[model samples]
Target: MESGLAGWVQTIGYIGIFAVVFAETGLLVGFALPGDSLLITVGILGAAGKLQLFPAITALFIGSFLGNNLGYWLGRWAGPGLQRRVRADHLERTQLFMRRFGALSLLVGPFIPIVRALVPFVCGTLRMPYGRFLPLTLLGSLIWTVGLTLFSYWVGSKIPNLEKYVYLILLVGISAGVVPAAIRFFRRRSARSVEM
Candidate 1:
């Protein structure tokens, strides 16, 4: 718990938690927020008796789920218009990718940063049936909220000096998301170059 982060978490409290989680899942601008770090901090605070676990988890779950849904709806409403302006082939690739890997993407999205926000939007843009999309989003939200929150709480309680290592944890968690995306990007670029 770096004092800066700790102080921010403490100062903002639960509303801050809800807002951040919601924005991270729903809004494009939210990709830059430190959602994983914030969740872990919330967990540590819960362990320290600063915030109650049930309410915190509830807020996080609702925020994350609704946020994803909102993004989906936004995509349904706005994505087609946007897609019309872009290359048709790019749009096809997006839909094709979603068709092939939609479930996996939904299940894994919340763990990633920008991708988390993009997943639902892309799914809706691709017109993935709502039936197929909802369950996976729910499962992902549960894991992202309950799983990570509880894990951090457990670690905070067990570790002697947990504060010192939080920044490292944040970096690792973020990297888990970013590194894969980076690899995919480079691979795609290399493939295109080879084609040329």
Candidate 2:
């Protein structure tokens, strides 16, 4: 994911941070996006004197916190009716999974791509209380945001010439993220075309 946006990642500054972190926590599609990497990238840039690590980290933390909160509320309000109408067996699966893994899912869901968004929605649909999720949400956000931010700074600093060609690294990161999916998408499309 960072490969795709490595160059732009460092140069684009706060805008990138806002987009990645917010999408990661708030949007279901963002599960695949590189919130962790972006933070690390930001830190790396800061360590190299290209960007400020503190502000980047702060923005990331706030973005993550708000994103999760928004997602949680969206799910809480969205509920089973939304699920039923949007019905696919996916919702049923969400319900079943929640019965067994609701707490764990809430804690760990943010790490996964598709599941992250769905889990929170499931929690809301299943009526998991906000009191139960509030602390957990904050904890998860901290773990994800701060931990990665520091790691990126440490790692970025150690690497040779990472800052020299930030764009290439960003491209590599984004390519790493989308290439597999693109391959899959094309394969599926080709398969469908053949069928027709």
What are the Cα lDDT values of the candidates? 0.78, 0.69
- lDDT per residue (tens digit) for residues 78-162 in model 1: 9877556545654455456556765788887677656676778788777778998899899989999999999999988887557
- Those runs of model 1 whose alpha carbons end farther than 4 Å from true positions after fitting are 82-100, 175-196
- Model number with the top lDDT: 1
lDDT of model 1, residue 153: 91
Model 1 residue 68 CA deviation in Å: 0.6
Ten-residue region with minimum lDDT total, candidate 2:
1-10
- What is the lDDT for 77 in model 2? 77
In candidate 2, what are the lDDT values of residues 1-196, reduced to their tens digit? 2344555776667766876777777755554676645775677777677777788887887887778777767777765455554347555555566677658776666554455556766666566788987787788777777776787678678886576665566578668868997999899999999999
Report the CA-based lDDT of candidate 1 relative to the real structure: 0.78
